[model samples]
Target chain A: MSKVSFSEEASVEVVTESFADTPDPRLKHILTSLVEHLHAFVKDIEPTEAEWEQAIGFLTATGHLCDDTRQEFVLLSDVLGVSMLVDAINNRKSVAATDTTVLGPFHMVESPPRDLGANISLDGNGEPCVFAGQVRSSDGTPLAGARVDVWQANGAGYYDVQQPDVQPERNLRGLFETDERGRFWLRTVVPRYYPIPDDGPVGRLLTATKRHPNRPAHIHVIAEAPGHASLTTHVFVEGSPYLDSDTVFGVKESLIRPVTNVDDPARAEHYGIANPFRLIEFDIILDPVRP
Target chain B: MSKVSFSEEASVEVVTESFADTPDPRLKHILTSLVEHLHAFVKDIEPTEAEWEQAIGFLTATGHLCDDTRQEFVLLSDVLGVSMLVDAINNRKSVAATDTTVLGPFHMVESPPRDLGANISLDGNGEPCVFAGQVRSSDGTPLAGARVDVWQANGAGYYDVQQPDVQPERNLRGLFETDERGRFWLRTVVPRYYPIPDDGPVGRLLTATKRHPNRPAHIHVIAEAPGHASLTTHVFVEGSPYLDSDTVFGVKESLIRPVTNVDDPARAEHYGIANPFRLIEFDIILDPVRP
Candidate 1:
């Protein structure tokens, strides 16, 4: 006495059963759960034909906006909070490990390796600042020889990819290797808080929902030390707007750091920067490799 | 105090609350429920970064495949049974009224008006048959002057739109007014079951799930009479393949009708067809308009 007939009551079972013969069990589980939740959503919303059509149109427009440079679906997912959730789910960390945020869509090109004292503000877009960071193990031991990959927007809040014709090649992007003291230092411009690319359908979605399209100013960091877990996170400026309400929900309290006025002439000279320059110092803690 | 954080536990509330100031209450409600369900699905699946990217890629591909001629998203919805569920939810019928089904994506063009008893098989590609039907109210009273719009795939299982160059415009499609006796008749070929347009992402999904893309043979009908609720449904061919397992879940026991031989030469003369021809007879019942 099997119920093969598809009815509203039997919808979840019927669809899930259709995927029962899937060769990949993980895919099967994912799809089965997807259908279950999707049906629940449809039944709960009970959208009319017009509303359904509107949704389809919205998705199609979102899709049409995607290309090599702009990935609207990822932006859609980012705005919906799914992207951050996926980041959190994938990068579960130990108590002392740096909190991982979304890798974001801008890290398409690899960061060119540079020396510790090299200046990354190639276009000289914003006020010069020193970014000094130390990578350490969760148990408070310094992690020497750690590779640090960093990328960020310029003072105008546009990644290099967004304005290739205007910005210098690989502006505000560099990969640095930490020293014996687990320290890495680089000179770059302060990244300004800017709106996400808001000309697309996802941008229109934000407008329609009364949501802003801005992410707080921050530097993207990816720290990978040998025999330690890799991390992808951001160090937010102390008083950036939208810090409390990141459009992508990537902000965390521990990740915010202040920009200090370091007036030491010797240290500034050693770093090849002017005295009284603005500096952002952050310490990154990484966990041991997961079993 | 309210929680403004965006942890996994606080994700649904945080995202939904962002839409709190939406001008439309229905939009707010739908978005809140959507966020809730979507987050639940993501948590349940706990997909990895690569898997999430794969999902984003899949949706993007599906959206990219949509155009004026082909709507891959609609096909995705059809294969998932959301289309059928939406139909059932929208068209709750009286006990005597015919059950409703998906309007389907093929009815993009209007059915050209034709005289009753006209032959609708423009290409004469399949075995000739006469389709005779009566339109009646749910109380069993014949409803004269009813409008009947009908469309179907050809014997080769292709709609005119799917083969625009080969088939005539409005082939296998007609809109007719019932006679004084509430009788409508037309000559057409028997529809054949066919796979849904399966070259796109949705089709690839079917292949991954080990499910066929075929829908059973059926003719789409939309019946409307003055002061009555218009209905869209189908009369399915009896014993058709995939009837019990329609890719779109559109089959119902009450909709099935068998093709039978009509040996009477007199009736054939009246229908302008050969004697002892095959015939399919169906009757439609409509409900009074809902308040």
Candidate 2:
């Protein structure tokens, strides 16, 4: 056999050339860049076969840890901050619009529709708080009838999905529509900072890296209306521990809302909640769809 | 609430800082580099949320496809040329030692010990071939009693593990010891080029990239001795269709060996094979252990 020697550099070239015929141009571009970056990483690491095998095992375990209710890969991306980085790059916000955040793994459950001012906290376990918000276009026009889907963990920092047996179905989850003034309101409890689902491969990774797995207390919102780009964002609580160190890096200054103490009885009665409740005013501003 | 805004660059810093307490310095370095590279990849791609979700799903399916007999992660690394690159970076060859290649996924079955010149092709199928080899140090000194573990697929391009019902146990696999002259020989069938296990996600990746999945015909060998670094490599068939385009980027010119047709009846009789058998001569050279 004639010698057909290939150096390490040559092998990379061969692999890149092999993808020249990819049918889709976007796929071709992505695959080409992926091959280059992947090979570059391998070269930089110079991992032994044993080390390489360990990576394979880690990734496989990460995959196995995912199911219908849990997504370890997304968590992996979250902890690595890849999810937030992608969000930042793809969802560049207009100066007047709300900033975007991670649509965390727990958003799979469809939120139950509720009337304005409905209390999503069915069990009434956490500290009383009222959330009022407005949905508007970038130009300040009210986006009446816009759909605002919301969900959050209870005071103990457990989503209904995480504690299905303990929490009532759809606890702290509601879908409300904006009224004539593009305003919406709901009664719920102040969300507590909580650790992400650990005990899986992602948890193991956190432990290995000496990093905590807590995300700051926040309510997830996905608001949408016709003729506007949909918005998926989190309204993080100010002063929550981990606010500066969110494991998923989902915090944005524009997304933080202060929890104010509302001591007036009449004002509380007007919203049908007790006096001295915690009040948070958050507003969603959506960008018009590009032509 | 005070604003705690994070830009794309700031998020990377936050993620990197989360690993501040990593106990192992090497792990800290690896984790830091990984985070940087991963974040860079995401920023470069700017994949939309849907594209990101598709990646998560693809990885999940890849992990689910792994089992005891099959390893989809390793296959994924192989198809991406990562395995070979890792092999190359860590196994730089001495000027005189044999070039190393991938220890493919199929080396799971242990080779049964056999005397020199034993026939490993017990099934009595395919074109007969005689394989002879020498084990030596890079300085050309004979390595007596060196263990040479050898294995290959059948002429049908299926490993015994891939076809347990048909192929006899231990067929096409043997462990031979080098004699005083540092020579070892075995009789087996010529291995045919075969497609990798592509019914899984890795295969789907290959299809999406517009690449073929065939590996060139080759015999795997792992030669080990107490005083030298172990060598794991392949003796690929020259003129194989996939020689220039092995899916795993495992081919190297120095590893290819011509299969010569030996028409001499006497030689065939000497080796206890039929006339016009195939003969391949391969040798193993190991590097001295570094002090």
- Top of the candidates by DockQ: 1
Interface alpha-carbon RMSD, every candidate: 2.1, 2.7
Task: Report the C-alpha displacement of residue A46, candidate 1, in angstroms.
Answer: 0.9
Off by over 4 Å in 1: A1-3, B1-3
Candidate 2 off by > 4 Å: A1-6, B1-5, B263-270, B274-276
Instruction: Summarize candidate 2's per-residue lDDT along A53-158 as a digit string, tens digits.
Output: 8889999899888889988999998888888888887778799999999889888789999999899998777888999989999999999999999999999999
Angstrom error of the Cα, residue A4, model 2: value is 7.9
Compose the digit string of candidate 2's lDDT tens values, residues B82-198: 888888888887889999999998889789999988999989766789998899999999999999999999999988998889999988999999999899888998889999999
TM-score of chain B of 1: 0.98
Candidate 2: lDDT of A1? 24
Checking candidate 2 for backbone clashes, the offending pairs are A4-B253
**Each candidate: what lDDT?**
0.90, 0.87
